[model samples]
Target: MSNIVKKFKVENGKGFKLGDFDPAYSDGFKKIEARKTLKDLIDETFDLQTELYAANKYALLIIFQAMDAAGKDSAIEHTLSGLNPQGCQVYSFKQPSTEDYEHDFLWRHYRSLPERGRIGIHNRSHYENVLVTKVHPDLLLKEHLPGINDVKDIDGKFWDKRYESIRAFEKHLTDNGTVIIKFYLNVSKQEQKLRFLKRIDNPKKNWKFSAADIEERKKWADYMDAYEKAIKETATNDCPWYVIPADKKWFTRIAISSVILDTLKGLKLKYPVLEKEEKDKLDESKKQLEKE
Candidate 1:
């Protein structure tokens, strides 16, 4: 196994434990260098990802969960840019539609799960049930979970149950064939404010800014609580969450890419082999063409 793969072994079947792995632990200018290194790692990983796709032995499902302006879109755009479009699919989870609300919370998510021999990216995944819903309890009106109304501590129990459900869902995916990698872009509040302000001030980025984003910021503490608990409770070794430090965009990108590359390397993927008869036939054809 490669060093990257050794660094990302699954522990206790719940979460991945990176003991001393720090992709962005550096000073001012050095951090920039680290980011570049990370980009290279991601590029290399995509090379392997294409091979894995061709091998058709396993599927990769990447989940990106982060607060607003935490660089989720940028990470996905840049990190996955090199992957073959046909082998890669990206799903951006938005507000649940009426039809989405009619089904269970995991309903929409299940539909987007990656099939065998492909890579699927989820921008904002089903964890919304625990994160966004916890922040805005009103959203729960869309789904009907028993005991939600009856429980006095709705926020606590609500998220706990959701975490349990998410764990089970991921375990099922792992048992079948999908390799699940969950990332939490842990951007500081100060960094988020700066990003949000940039979005507001820049004319080109204005369209990306929404007034409701500020409302969400007001409940930052609640969201943090929800995220902390969800990660702690549900980060099994089978499908673990990587809490990426996003204060530096470059570092965040590299760290993410390294983690991803590590995961793919561990899968021990390779190009498919042809049968001896097929190789002999190809060799014979080459000899016949040469004679012509």
Candidate 2:
């Protein structure tokens, strides 16, 4: 499991390329084998989460970024199922609301951050400012920035600044006890097309199929380039990106669960121990309760 985490983790941005990863790779684990591994990982994560909540020293921020139909939702659902709801918060960032566009790109995301001792899951995150907007430069126009008056104005220097902003933002969060884990579900174009077809073919899934999805699909190459650039620019040792394979949903879930469990274990969280005074008080209270 540690090897799998290391294999997919991007700790440094230097010379990173998304295409180097195989979307269908499963690390020799069949579905049956992965199921058992996933269960054990989830159970351990649950126990660690309890200690984490009691310690109240660190907040886990898990971010997922992917193309359409890359199984981000399902992977999150299956992997984080064992978490205590009271200690977990999930935010799915969609098309920016009117209010969202009015502030700096990270404003809404900052508002949604989890407090210490909790886990926050972002379905799609502030990376969208770099990934989606980089792919469709026109979206920056909606941000209503002074210099970004036209798509043409969003040049190489503009993108470099956004990437720099992201790196600084993540650094500040990590310094403030936010443990960030980023995942990029690397789904191949062929698999994405098949998933899109299934949504269209199944009556129950028809609602999941959007015409806009196809429009995004048409720019798959552009998205890939943007993702590569974003990962290369912002990945750091403290905040690495895990490019998880998404062609096989089962494998994706297992890999993600392993990474999360590894992260929690690294934190070395422990349930708070009572001091001598508190222990004595508890003993005295127990004696009174017994008399009653």
Candidate 3:
């Protein structure tokens, strides 16, 4: 675990520090080997998750946030590939609809929360209440938070209050047996530009490119400030955030898999056992079937 954490540097309010991994020492073959190892670990983790689901002990909520081309989709597709589809659900939040805007910020999000004994993944989640709303103050007018209408320096206070609300909301969920793991895919600006260029150069990927994305890139600094503040304010022990380095795809996959495996490990799940009478009945049934 320590070796995995040392591979990437994670940054937050406490300041930047090396993660439990050092990927630089790993060559291409070594990285591939690590990914293969991660695949096996994830398979075992899914078995545990299935057992945990049957036990109805808890629900797992994973949130993924990242800039365009940060491998958010790929990370999820690969890392969660081993889990049973029935036990997992994925929701991708796009632009808000009129119905979505009609309610409070978390209304759409709460609607998608996982049931007991299931895993829910949010592609881009309710944190957008702070991130996108900060970038475009006009969006707040759509939220309709009471008392926010007349507040002075409303931009700063609005987000501050929202952060507090989010923290409390997540705490309530945690208290109710939901384990939340938030991930922020940190990619450098240079890498983002290269990815954007790739979209232009490739015909199939071009469908994902948008003019609005370019417009958003101009506010990169503003978005970063919003992300930095939101992460610092909302991260808590019960619902901690894992900042993942998105430079190398294999490293990102391994880091995500490790974090998820570690989180699930603490659940201590086991398959349910049959009572003595039930076991005897099963043996008799097997004997009858064998005679047939």
Candidate 4:
């Protein structure tokens, strides 16, 4: 296990306080130092991922949930660099489409799960059903779940039931060989504001800025409350959430890569063993090739 993993992990997530974490925390690595560490992490991941692909047993699911400008995209781009693209799939969940609205909240996410021997990365995941929806309960009417027409009746029990659904969903995945690691990029409001401004000022990044992002920023407290409650309800020993500081993009990238590499290494994966008959066949084939 990596020493840094525990530093960011949300153990016994119930009653975990988001306030206890610092979004600007960087483990004392300045940008240049962190960039060097990031390179090393990316290099080490390729062999580990090849082992995972060869072992063909466990699938890894990485979930990143964060407010705008928290650098989820950069984290995914930087941390997973040099990974075998064939062994990985990344999905970024956006607003639910009409098709998404017709199914259970987890259905869309379920379709994107990684198969055995692969890594599935969710830029934003099913947790949105709790975090964003919890912050904006009005969005629930769109789901059209049974017995939820009256928004007034949608009380604590409704959210609690949703939390139960999330727990069961993750537990089911764990039982079926999928390992889940959830990350909440804890970015400060001030940092997010600065990032958003950068996006606005930079021509290349102007399109990335959304008025809705600023609108969402206004409700940061509500989102934080929702995140706290959802993490409390759904976090477990099998599927843990890591709230990583994101004020420094470099640090976020390295920290995330460390957790991912540590998780993959901890699996203790091995290549498939060949039987004597298989070994003999390979040796014979090698001899025939030598003759050719």
Weakest 10 consecutive residues of candidate 1 by summed lDDT: 18-27
Tens-place lDDT per residue, model 2, 217-284, is: 99988999999999999999999999999999999999999999999999999888899999999999
Residue lDDT tens for model 3, 1-292: 5455434323334543323323223324357486677788788788788887888878999999988888899999989988898999999999889999888788899999999899999999999878887788776766666665643447666677789899999989999998898888887777888889999999999998999889999998988888877777876767777777787777787788888887788888777798999999999999999999
Candidate 1 off by > 4 Å: 1-31, 146-158, 288-292
What are the models' TM-scores? Answer: 0.86, 0.98, 0.88, 0.97
Candidate 2: give the clashing pairs.
none
Q: What is the lDDT of residue 173 in candidate 4?
A: 93
Q: lDDT (CA) for every model shown?
A: 0.79, 0.94, 0.80, 0.90
Angstrom error at residue 124, model 1: 0.5
Candidate 1: tens digits of C-alpha lDDT, residues 1-292: 1433333333443433332334233223366486567667867887898788789888899999989998999999878877678888999999999899889999999999988889999999999988888777877865766665643447655666777888899999999889999888877788889989999899999999999999989998888877866776777778877777677887677667778888898899889988999999999999999999
Error of 2 at 89 (Å): 0.7
